[model samples]
Target: MKSLITAPLLLISGFLFLTLAAARPQLNVLMISVDDLRDWTNFLGGYDGEVFTPHMDALAERGISFTNAHCPSPVCNPSRTSVMTGLMPSTTGIYSNSQWLRPNHPEATTLPQFFKDRGFKVVGSGKSFHHTAGNNPPDQWHDYFRFPWADFPWTRSNKLNYPWTEWQPPPPEYPFSKVEYLRGKDERDWGILPRKESKYDDVVIVDYAIDFLESHSGDPFFLSVGTFHPHLPWYIPKRFHDLYADSEIQLPVFPENDLDNIPPIPRKWAEARRDEMQAARDAGEWEEAVRCYLASISFADAQVGRVLEALENSHFAKSTIIVLWSDHGFHLGEKGHWMKSTLWEEATRVPFIIATPGMENSGQSSSRPVNLVSIFPTLVSLLSLESNTDFDGPDLTPLLANPDAEWSHPSLIDFGYGNTAVRNEHWRYIRYNDGTEELYDHQTDPNEWKNLADHPMYQKVKDNLAEYLPESYTENVPGKNAFVFDPENWTFTNKETGRVVHGRQ
Candidate 1:
């Protein structure tokens, strides 16, 4: 009788053990980013012009592709700040590229910080932040490693070379040379190359990411690897450039009369950027720019492939969530915008593909307008994380489960202070604080050939989008904390309340 009782107890205990094992956290995350990568790549449904990114194509094929994902802002700093903190530019108070984000909100909980708080080993490297200057927060990362090939070489400065410039690395098998400089570190003009194989930022960053996986052996970890390429000076070794020729490359589709219908603000912006691109093309340097951009993208793609390959090769493939995205897209002379800071589709829209473990259906696509801000809540839902009310983004896991899930909110894009745009499936709407507005029907005008803001019929649609914008902004007001960073410049304060604005302010 005692033996029987013990056997039943033992069976119950075994069942409980299995239950715990199944319920225990066995998740890992790998978030990768590329700089100035637009939707022009063949993989992300970009037009087949001069570029081919097979690795990215493969990654997109295995993940849930968000065709209309956009950044909070067009510029790098604010956009990245939004992604990192999962907060809008108004709330975060990180309005521009020059402002240092951390000092403004020292107590704020970043995405990495949240994951790190949950006992996950968080590691970051490369251009994950806005400026790529200063040390990372301790709470956000348990370990941080800078990738070697991750940064640009200072020897190939665009400003230094001026008119006729081509950035080239050292010849054959002997990677780019590293030259250390202390004078202009924070200035955007400076670049740096890697020393040895181990020093290559991309190689080093990925190596450490894979190393983190091996070290944990089976534990969960969150690793963020940022690749800085395809940005400016389009610097890469000759081998990558050699892969393409002017004959094989097709120019971007920018019509001569492309600006007929666009709003004045956007038209002017695009025209300026287009001229810069035209100068490069006229100087017989368009192919060089294209080759370098594509090569850098391909190079970054190769690095990404390695990380994904490592996961598949390791035991973590079954439980890892791989998210690859660009902070914002770059322009290869499309829409007249050369390098972001515009509200056009090319500059605002980004490539967002997520390969979640255990998600059976692959190669799924969603037309829903989603913002990078949604990344926080999406991860929380996927990981079955503890509920928290602080996060503003809604869980997008349902979309992953059913690609046709019902999600109908227009994704919002922020420009400079008081400028905002809302993108829906059929229409794009914009409202500037100076009372300027723009509207475009994407179906009729994909290239924004016509601005329908003056049309009387679309008033309802414009009003609808305007309602989505915050009526009265709250939280991170510019002047309150901005002076800490830049004392000379006066930020936009609450005109009415005299106190810092609230609610998207």
Candidate 2:
């Protein structure tokens, strides 16, 4: 009789355990991606003047802000591919925007695919991946909208046939900034768009995200909402431009001899956009360009606010995890560069924040040097998913739990095949493909105005940071010139090797 009673009690306890486990809700992920956003927000304080970023600042308050986060690569295609696939550019050979991900790496499971495989409703809109035709495969998500500018009339009319094309026809007085160099070049131009903000691509993308948040109910979701603002052609609504007064706009500190200490490789990177910088300076439109960028950032912040408001109103708000990050940082006349693709502090340091449900250390900040490559594995850990050994980055759950955890790992930023930058808490060490190096002690030079790699005193420091560099870099895969891409069939045929690879439609 005693044995029978014991058996019944044990069965009841086991049933209760299973029931509790089954009733627990799975954590959903809301990934917000901002393209080419640097550390200029109100929180990061990378800028000198007032930058309107209330939404991003509030989001930082809700999570652990990684102040030292850097991209896996300093360019879009390579950096996004590395973040999504959990592989470094050095390992995948995806070192530039010209190379397509699917044609080169067919087997790597992307972050969304990892969740989708485990029964999550994956959806995305806007420039989540590189906003190119072949780079963002459809099968990665259950539903996705490509960089929405492709649907605009100006884009469809071939007036500007690029993904980052102007969303609408320029105002008749084009080059609104009155800079002659930007007259025909739409990519570099920035001005007030004489239209309603509702019609913009970033606004439309945020609307899609809001709709999904409101209506989503079934399986846990992995929703990616990407904003393509503050990227290029900073053309935005007039209201955003109104936020910044020209008198309040402060230009970045431009040292006349800033490039004198760097190696030849990065010197070339600085000179790459010198002509554009010169034109802006020559026209005295530098302040206007900075104002446009600030306005664009405010515009992007508004879009993020829309999505956050929708999520808060939805039922999934309490159960969801919010991860906001930029693909890579931008250089707005810093280091004498106008765009990304450099391995400098401005080009590599991005805005990274992860807000998990019921986080104990909320509103805290972490200065641990972390790479965006950790995003994939970090999400996998947060969701309690099976670990994959193929990830080159470590699980960042430890840092999430404790912002000041003992983390020795340095953030690695790769540019080209052999050009890499290792950034830890104190120093930034850059090694070019040709073996020339540049080292800056961040302790003394936060602006990186000086190079210390040539000094024997910092040789030990350089050696310590150099250990984090890639042991070997993979050779670059076939670029667009080496393959014929058939958009109709979604396939790439290598011209020389005759190898055919099918891409997801």
Candidate 3:
């Protein structure tokens, strides 16, 4: 009887020890992406004096804010592609919005796909990829939500108000509310998306994300919530719009002769788009447009706050890693351009925040210039998961673990089809495929208002950054030109060569 009791006790004690030894804590990831969000806020304090993003300010207050974070490319598709695949836009050959990523890079491993392979339930909603909504791979998610913006009353009214208008607001067949701020203005006037009290698309995204958390109880999960506002025709709820009135809102300062030192191609491109911009300005639509953009950003922030709240309240809060990023930055009438297709800071610097469990209380900042491509490998290292072979970025786990640690590479930004720009600690170097270049000492010219490329005093600085440019980009690709719009016709393909050959190239 004594031997039997001793044996049972020993067995129980051994089991307990092993359980304690092998047990890994629960881990979850909350990745929130906002479209066209620029890093011109209180965090980096990039703006001359603007104070818009309060929720993002709070986020920066809680975690790490990458002062020099940038997209792989200035355009959406390539930027998002680089972000998801951990490959630079050049390596992936996804340079423009017209270029579809699926057929071209089918073999590429996506950020969420990697997590899914590790037994984590992954769910996505809104616009994570460029048009992933219409042509999403069924296997990408355990489940996904694609809510229609059609039911928005503002979208319905826009069509009626501007019958000849080429740009219509989203469709109005879906369920949402029309939250109005100003008394008598039509939905189009305010440029605000309609919303149902708590059922807005942004709100819905958070709702589903939190719901996933509840259902997955003990299992690890990866939730990616993409907010579509603050993109085009910047629309937001009325309450957000009222946050900035006409007089209170400041217009983007139009730099006098900003194009004076830029190259011919970029300068000419800006000039070509001048007519449409002037039309909007002449009609007093630009400021309203700017106000709408600011409001949309605030709207996106509120949605972000919801997700953060859920994470904090969940049991997995102590173990989860929260990352929020914008697909790429946008130009709100900067460089006489209103979109994201240039190497300018307005078009390249995106909002990046990473909040880890143990590091949650450690709010820090890094001006270390890292690309969005680094996200994949960093997550892999953070989770200590099985390593894979498909990656073109370095794991930034060391940097995040100790941001003050030394790094060898400067972050590269692929702007236009072949234009490349790199941000070092103190300088911004840009090189166009046509052999044109621009260099600016960010310390002296924070706005990049002056070009030091021609200045002989900083020749060494320029040479160092140039050496950092990848040779892959300098080498030519098949059926491609250095400065043409689309080197590879992404929409259509050639039968004989299996390459994109016809349309834009």
Candidate 4:
């Protein structure tokens, strides 16, 4: 299928910052990012019944799959910042979606920029870093396509052809089109697109990536192909939806009293989605909503298939290293919560896979609890690239070499100040701002249903896990373009004119 948007043979932007020696053999890197995808794929088995994701499962078979991977933060901006910069959100003071990292943490080196500094060609397209251009360093790439996204992103030329008014990722509330099953208003919506596949923005991204892969041969390139699907509004092609039957769709295992057992902070967050859940139940659209999400994921998988095929068919396939990951996990009404931005397992857990060409021991699943915060260092270690700075997460070469490596490093997940969750092999310990705690034994309760934080028997467990939380943390950084944050008072002031805006906690 062709892109509905104007066909560009190539989307190239970036200048050569460093020079590569003629004799050196550079390794190519292919980074694939899927937005808001949870562990519902066939390989993860988090979701019951059937979820169609053949391409991703195939990719998992070709690399070391981190079965127990979690994002630093559940939100898009902060999670991407941590992964790209290899810096934790607490250290950088970037906690919210509005907070931009490039300005807040200027000294840190990004994953692609690190490669660029090492005399490698970096190319990117679509949503690599938080969907904001500022998060993506313009000068770091050899070539990049900043625009050209799924379904009428911008451009007055094709505006009339597509219905911008009705078709989009939900407006955080009800009234879904096409699925007709959703009868009432609620938070989050979904629908299948009736237009041409070329209109899809992600398809254009793959096209640009394929163009680069086929044309470029000798230079070591770091290609980032980002896909914005299965994120929200669940807008996707009808054909992908056909792959799944509604009868085969399985609903999430939502406990009736899950929120009652949740800690204060997360319980409060989960309560906000009460209206959304209630609406879903009232309308009997629970399965329909999940159906669209799974379909959108399958659509995303198809895009991955397209990009991988291009890379495999390319001359550099044998020497390239492929790393596929999502910014964070999504919540399809798991913990009575609708979306991400919590310290729970559903929101923080993500799909992380690393495939290096000719690795002796490949296609293994490492069940070790690992955080995505150190993706920068992990890649650097795998590629043997040089960096001027250190990273929060260390070299996982040992784990990659041996999936059952004895690792004591527990995965740490955080959301703003005073709230953190530490996940080890067995336990998930959560400490909120109010000094209250919640713990879950993953071995007995994979769904994290039973909060054993107050269990007298597990006090030692909490003490030991508390050791993994961040030692030092700054107040949340306010966006320079948007607002100014006062760490001392936990308040937000207007950026311009220094007027007192509002107090935040």
Give the candidate number with the greatest TM-score. Answer: 2
Residue 12 C-alpha lDDT in model 1: 17
Instruction: Please give the CA lDDT of all the candidate structures.
Output: 0.65, 0.83, 0.67, 0.74
* Residue 260 displacement (Å), model 1: 4.8
Judging by TM-score, tell me the better candidate of 2 and 3.
2
Per-residue lDDT over 1-505 for candidate 3, one digit per residue giving the tens place of the 0 to 100 score: 0010111111111332233224545567888888888876678775554556777788787778888888888877778877787778767666766555454445556777778888888888877877422224446677877544532434333432223224444444221222232222333233655555376667776788778766666558888888876776455667888777644666677688878998886776566546545656776677776777778787888888777777778777776778888878877677788667778788888889887765623578877888888887677766666444455566666556566668777888885556789887888899887988888788888778888788888888888898977676422222212212222232334345555422211
Sorted on lDDT, best first, the list reads: 2, 4, 3, 1
Candidate 4: stretches off by over 4 Å? 1-24, 147-187, 480-505
How close is each model in CA RMSD to the real structure?
Answer: 10.7, 7.8, 11.0, 9.5
Q: Pick the candidate with the highest lDDT.
A: 2
Preferred candidate (TM-score higher): 2 or 4: 2
| Structural similarity to truth (TM-score) of each candidate | 0.80, 0.92, 0.81, 0.85
lDDT, candidate 1, residue 381? 60
TM-score of 4: 0.85
lDDT of 4 by residue, 188-253 (tens): 567666568877877888888999988986568899999988787677778888887544787777
lDDT of 4 at 480: 50
Global lDDT of model 4: 0.74
Show where candidate 1 strays beyond 4 Å.
1-24, 147-199, 260-264, 271-275, 387-389, 474-505
